[model samples]
Target: MSQAEASQLLGLAGKYRPYPEYKGAGVEWVGDVPEHWRVGRLGSFGYFIAGCGFPHEDQGRQDEIYPFYKVSDTNHVGNEKYLSKADNYVSKDIASKLGARICSAGDYVSQGRGCVAWKQEANSYSGNSDNKCDTHG
Candidate 1:
Protein backbone atom coordinates (compact mmCIF):
# COMPACT_ATOMS: atom_id res chain seq x y z
CA MET A 1 0.00 0.00 0.00
CA SER A 2 1.05 3.59 -0.54
CA GLN A 3 2.33 5.58 2.44
CA ALA A 4 -0.67 7.91 2.37
CA GLU A 5 -3.14 5.03 2.19
CA ALA A 6 -1.46 3.23 5.05
CA SER A 7 -1.43 6.39 7.14
CA GLN A 8 -5.13 6.95 6.55
CA LEU A 9 -5.96 3.39 7.59
CA LEU A 10 -3.86 3.78 10.73
CA GLY A 11 -5.72 6.98 11.73
CA LEU A 12 -2.62 9.11 11.65
CA ALA A 13 -4.39 12.05 10.07
CA GLY A 14 -4.47 13.78 13.52
CA LYS A 15 -8.25 13.90 13.63
CA TYR A 16 -10.13 11.91 16.27
CA ARG A 17 -12.62 9.35 15.02
CA PRO A 18 -14.51 7.13 17.43
CA TYR A 19 -14.72 3.42 16.85
CA PRO A 20 -17.84 1.27 17.43
CA GLU A 21 -18.77 0.50 21.05
CA TYR A 22 -15.31 1.01 22.61
CA LYS A 23 -14.88 2.24 26.19
CA GLY A 24 -11.86 1.26 28.21
CA ALA A 25 -9.47 2.69 30.80
CA GLY A 26 -5.82 3.42 29.97
CA VAL A 27 -6.78 3.68 26.33
CA GLU A 28 -6.76 7.30 25.28
CA TRP A 29 -7.80 6.55 21.73
CA VAL A 30 -8.88 3.80 19.45
CA GLY A 31 -6.72 2.53 16.55
CA ASP A 32 -3.67 2.79 18.80
CA VAL A 33 -3.57 -1.01 18.94
CA PRO A 34 -5.30 -4.02 17.48
CA GLU A 35 -8.77 -4.78 18.83
CA HIS A 36 -7.64 -7.99 20.51
CA TRP A 37 -4.50 -6.55 22.09
CA ARG A 38 -4.44 -6.05 25.86
CA VAL A 39 -2.40 -3.59 27.88
CA GLY A 40 -0.79 -4.63 31.20
CA ARG A 41 2.03 -3.78 33.56
CA LEU A 42 5.56 -5.16 33.13
CA GLY A 43 5.20 -7.08 36.41
CA SER A 44 2.13 -8.85 35.00
CA PHE A 45 3.98 -9.75 31.80
CA GLY A 46 7.14 -11.02 33.58
CA TYR A 47 9.27 -10.76 36.72
CA PHE A 48 11.92 -8.06 37.13
CA ILE A 49 15.08 -8.83 39.11
CA ALA A 50 18.29 -6.90 39.81
CA GLY A 51 21.84 -8.28 40.09
CA CYS A 52 24.50 -8.13 42.83
CA GLY A 53 28.10 -6.99 42.81
CA PHE A 54 31.24 -9.09 43.45
CA PRO A 55 34.44 -7.67 44.87
CA HIS A 56 36.87 -7.29 41.96
CA GLU A 57 39.99 -7.97 44.05
CA ASP A 58 38.71 -11.06 45.86
CA GLN A 59 37.65 -13.02 42.75
CA GLY A 60 40.10 -15.81 41.82
CA ARG A 61 41.01 -17.90 38.81
CA GLN A 62 41.31 -21.68 38.86
CA ASP A 63 40.37 -24.91 37.01
CA GLU A 64 37.02 -25.33 35.25
CA ILE A 65 36.26 -22.44 32.92
CA TYR A 66 33.04 -20.41 32.99
CA PRO A 67 31.78 -17.35 31.15
CA PHE A 68 31.24 -14.18 33.16
CA TYR A 69 28.89 -11.58 31.70
CA LYS A 70 28.31 -7.93 32.56
CA VAL A 71 25.75 -5.30 31.56
CA SER A 72 28.16 -3.65 29.12
CA ASP A 73 28.54 -6.97 27.25
CA THR A 74 24.92 -6.67 26.07
CA ASN A 75 24.31 -4.24 23.23
CA HIS A 76 23.03 -4.20 19.61
CA VAL A 77 24.40 -7.66 18.80
CA GLY A 78 24.42 -9.22 22.32
CA ASN A 79 27.21 -10.39 24.67
CA GLU A 80 29.87 -11.58 22.20
CA LYS A 81 32.91 -11.09 24.45
CA TYR A 82 33.72 -12.86 27.71
CA LEU A 83 33.68 -10.34 30.54
CA SER A 84 36.09 -12.40 32.65
CA LYS A 85 38.17 -15.53 32.21
CA ALA A 86 36.75 -18.68 33.81
CA ASP A 87 40.08 -19.41 35.46
CA ASN A 88 39.32 -16.32 37.57
CA TYR A 89 36.42 -17.76 39.52
CA VAL A 90 34.61 -16.97 42.76
CA SER A 91 34.16 -19.33 45.66
CA LYS A 92 30.77 -20.99 46.31
CA ASP A 93 30.74 -19.53 49.83
CA ILE A 94 31.03 -16.00 48.47
CA ALA A 95 28.51 -16.71 45.74
CA SER A 96 25.97 -17.95 48.26
CA LYS A 97 26.43 -15.02 50.67
CA LEU A 98 25.75 -12.61 47.84
CA GLY A 99 22.62 -14.49 46.69
CA ALA A 100 23.23 -14.74 42.99
CA ARG A 101 20.73 -16.18 40.55
CA ILE A 102 21.77 -18.65 37.87
CA CYS A 103 20.64 -18.06 34.31
CA SER A 104 20.60 -20.54 31.42
CA ALA A 105 20.57 -20.25 27.66
CA GLY A 106 17.78 -18.19 26.10
CA ASP A 107 17.58 -16.08 29.25
CA TYR A 108 17.08 -12.34 28.82
CA VAL A 109 19.43 -9.78 30.39
CA SER A 110 18.69 -6.06 30.43
CA GLN A 111 20.39 -2.95 31.71
CA GLY A 112 18.48 -0.79 34.15
CA ARG A 113 19.49 2.74 33.13
CA GLY A 114 22.73 3.50 31.36
CA CYS A 115 22.38 1.63 28.03
CA VAL A 116 18.75 0.55 28.35
CA ALA A 117 18.98 -2.49 26.11
CA TRP A 118 18.03 -6.16 26.46
CA LYS A 119 19.88 -9.22 25.15
CA GLN A 120 19.01 -12.92 25.21
CA GLU A 121 21.38 -15.88 25.07
CA ALA A 122 22.56 -18.93 26.98
CA ASN A 123 25.06 -18.25 29.75
CA SER A 124 28.24 -20.37 30.04
CA TYR A 125 28.13 -20.71 33.81
CA SER A 126 25.64 -23.22 35.18
CA GLY A 127 26.86 -22.51 38.71
CA ASN A 128 25.80 -19.53 40.82
CA SER A 129 27.52 -16.21 41.55
CA ASP A 130 26.51 -12.79 42.81
CA ASN A 131 25.59 -11.12 39.51
CA LYS A 132 23.44 -8.17 38.46
CA CYS A 133 20.18 -10.13 38.49
CA ASP A 134 20.62 -10.79 42.20
CA THR A 135 20.34 -7.09 43.03
CA HIS A 136 17.11 -6.78 41.10
CA GLY A 137 15.48 -9.73 42.86
Candidate 2:
Protein backbone atom coordinates (compact mmCIF):
# COMPACT_ATOMS: atom_id res chain seq x y z
CA MET A 1 0.00 0.00 0.00
CA SER A 2 2.43 2.64 -1.18
CA GLN A 3 1.37 6.25 -1.77
CA ALA A 4 1.32 5.69 -5.56
CA GLU A 5 -0.78 2.56 -5.12
CA ALA A 6 -3.18 4.36 -2.80
CA SER A 7 -3.49 7.29 -5.20
CA GLN A 8 -4.12 4.91 -8.09
CA LEU A 9 -6.80 3.13 -6.09
CA LEU A 10 -8.52 6.43 -5.23
CA GLY A 11 -8.25 7.48 -8.87
CA LEU A 12 -10.00 4.29 -9.87
CA ALA A 13 -12.80 5.14 -7.41
CA GLY A 14 -13.08 8.58 -9.01
CA LYS A 15 -14.21 6.86 -12.21
CA TYR A 16 -17.66 6.43 -10.69
CA ARG A 17 -20.13 9.08 -11.90
CA PRO A 18 -23.45 10.31 -10.54
CA TYR A 19 -26.72 10.46 -12.44
CA PRO A 20 -27.04 13.32 -14.96
CA GLU A 21 -29.52 15.28 -12.79
CA TYR A 22 -29.00 16.27 -9.14
CA LYS A 23 -30.63 18.38 -6.42
CA GLY A 24 -29.66 19.84 -3.06
CA ALA A 25 -29.58 17.43 -0.08
CA GLY A 26 -30.40 20.36 2.35
CA VAL A 27 -27.30 19.72 4.48
CA GLU A 28 -24.17 21.73 3.67
CA TRP A 29 -21.85 18.75 3.77
CA VAL A 30 -24.11 16.81 1.40
CA GLY A 31 -24.37 19.27 -1.46
CA ASP A 32 -26.21 17.15 -3.98
CA VAL A 33 -27.51 13.69 -4.73
CA PRO A 34 -29.33 11.93 -7.55
CA GLU A 35 -32.81 13.46 -7.95
CA HIS A 36 -34.37 10.04 -7.68
CA TRP A 37 -32.80 9.41 -4.29
CA ARG A 38 -34.32 10.95 -1.16
CA VAL A 39 -32.13 12.13 1.70
CA GLY A 40 -33.07 11.67 5.35
CA ARG A 41 -31.49 11.83 8.79
CA LEU A 42 -29.71 8.68 9.94
CA GLY A 43 -31.84 8.74 13.13
CA SER A 44 -35.04 8.65 11.06
CA PHE A 45 -34.46 5.14 9.78
CA GLY A 46 -33.33 3.52 13.04
CA TYR A 47 -33.34 3.84 16.83
CA PHE A 48 -30.06 5.16 18.19
CA ILE A 49 -28.80 3.84 21.56
CA ALA A 50 -26.13 5.96 23.14
CA GLY A 51 -23.34 4.28 25.09
CA CYS A 52 -22.89 4.63 28.90
CA GLY A 53 -20.19 4.62 31.52
CA PHE A 54 -18.56 1.45 32.92
CA PRO A 55 -15.63 0.88 35.18
CA HIS A 56 -12.46 0.08 33.27
CA GLU A 57 -11.28 -2.50 35.80
CA ASP A 58 -14.21 -4.69 34.80
CA GLN A 59 -13.13 -4.57 31.14
CA GLY A 60 -10.43 -6.56 29.23
CA ARG A 61 -11.29 -9.76 31.06
CA GLN A 62 -11.46 -12.79 28.80
CA ASP A 63 -13.35 -14.89 31.34
CA GLU A 64 -16.31 -12.55 31.40
CA ILE A 65 -19.60 -13.60 29.79
CA TYR A 66 -20.55 -10.41 27.87
CA PRO A 67 -18.46 -8.41 25.41
CA PHE A 68 -17.74 -4.83 26.50
CA TYR A 69 -17.02 -2.61 23.52
CA LYS A 70 -14.66 0.30 24.05
CA VAL A 71 -13.04 2.89 21.81
CA SER A 72 -9.99 0.65 21.45
CA ASP A 73 -12.09 -2.17 20.02
CA THR A 74 -12.70 -0.04 16.93
CA ASN A 75 -9.03 -0.44 16.02
CA HIS A 76 -9.57 -4.05 15.00
CA VAL A 77 -9.74 -4.15 11.18
CA GLY A 78 -11.78 -7.33 10.59
CA ASN A 79 -14.57 -6.11 12.92
CA GLU A 80 -15.47 -3.26 10.53
CA LYS A 81 -18.13 -5.54 8.98
CA TYR A 82 -19.55 -6.93 12.26
CA LEU A 83 -18.56 -7.04 15.88
CA SER A 84 -18.00 -10.77 16.14
CA LYS A 85 -15.13 -10.34 18.57
CA ALA A 86 -14.17 -7.86 21.24
CA ASP A 87 -10.97 -7.09 23.15
CA ASN A 88 -12.81 -6.54 26.42
CA TYR A 89 -15.46 -8.41 28.35
CA VAL A 90 -17.77 -7.92 31.31
CA SER A 91 -20.12 -10.01 33.38
CA LYS A 92 -23.89 -9.83 32.94
CA ASP A 93 -24.32 -8.35 36.42
CA ILE A 94 -21.66 -5.74 35.77
CA ALA A 95 -23.24 -4.76 32.48
CA SER A 96 -26.65 -4.48 34.08
CA LYS A 97 -25.30 -2.25 36.82
CA LEU A 98 -23.59 0.01 34.34
CA GLY A 99 -26.81 0.26 32.35
CA ALA A 100 -24.82 -0.22 29.17
CA ARG A 101 -26.97 -0.02 26.09
CA ILE A 102 -27.37 -3.32 24.29
CA CYS A 103 -27.74 -3.65 20.55
CA SER A 104 -30.75 -5.65 19.51
CA ALA A 105 -30.68 -8.31 16.85
CA GLY A 106 -29.74 -6.80 13.46
CA ASP A 107 -28.67 -3.53 15.03
CA TYR A 108 -25.71 -1.57 13.65
CA VAL A 109 -22.92 0.18 15.55
CA SER A 110 -20.36 2.88 14.72
CA GLN A 111 -18.03 5.38 16.31
CA GLY A 112 -19.53 8.77 17.13
CA ARG A 113 -16.64 10.79 15.72
CA GLY A 114 -13.63 10.31 13.43
CA CYS A 115 -13.58 7.61 10.75
CA VAL A 116 -17.04 6.10 10.98
CA ALA A 117 -16.68 2.33 10.86
CA TRP A 118 -20.26 1.06 10.82
CA LYS A 119 -20.89 -2.60 11.51
CA GLN A 120 -23.99 -4.68 12.22
CA GLU A 121 -24.07 -7.73 14.43
CA ALA A 122 -26.11 -10.84 13.88
CA ASN A 123 -26.91 -11.00 17.60
CA SER A 124 -27.29 -8.67 20.59
CA TYR A 125 -24.31 -7.07 22.36
CA SER A 126 -23.41 -4.36 24.86
CA GLY A 127 -21.12 -1.32 24.91
CA ASN A 128 -19.37 0.81 27.56
CA SER A 129 -17.83 3.67 25.60
CA ASP A 130 -19.92 6.45 27.25
CA ASN A 131 -21.31 8.43 24.27
CA LYS A 132 -18.61 7.43 21.81
CA CYS A 133 -20.90 5.14 19.82
CA ASP A 134 -24.12 5.32 17.82
CA THR A 135 -26.05 2.04 17.99
CA HIS A 136 -29.02 1.59 15.69
CA GLY A 137 -31.81 -0.73 16.64
Global Cα RMSD, each model: 9.5, 7.2
lDDT of 1 by residue, 16-66 (tens): 554444334364543244445566665766565565564566445443123
The models' CA-based lDDT, in order, is: 0.40, 0.59
Candidate 1 to truth, TM: 0.45
List TM-score per model, in order. 0.45, 0.65
Weakest 10 consecutive residues, lDDT, candidate 1? Answer: 112-121
- Quote the positional error of residue 112 for candidate 2 in Å: 3.3
The candidate maximizing lDDT is 2
CA shift at 33, candidate 2, in angstroms? 1.3
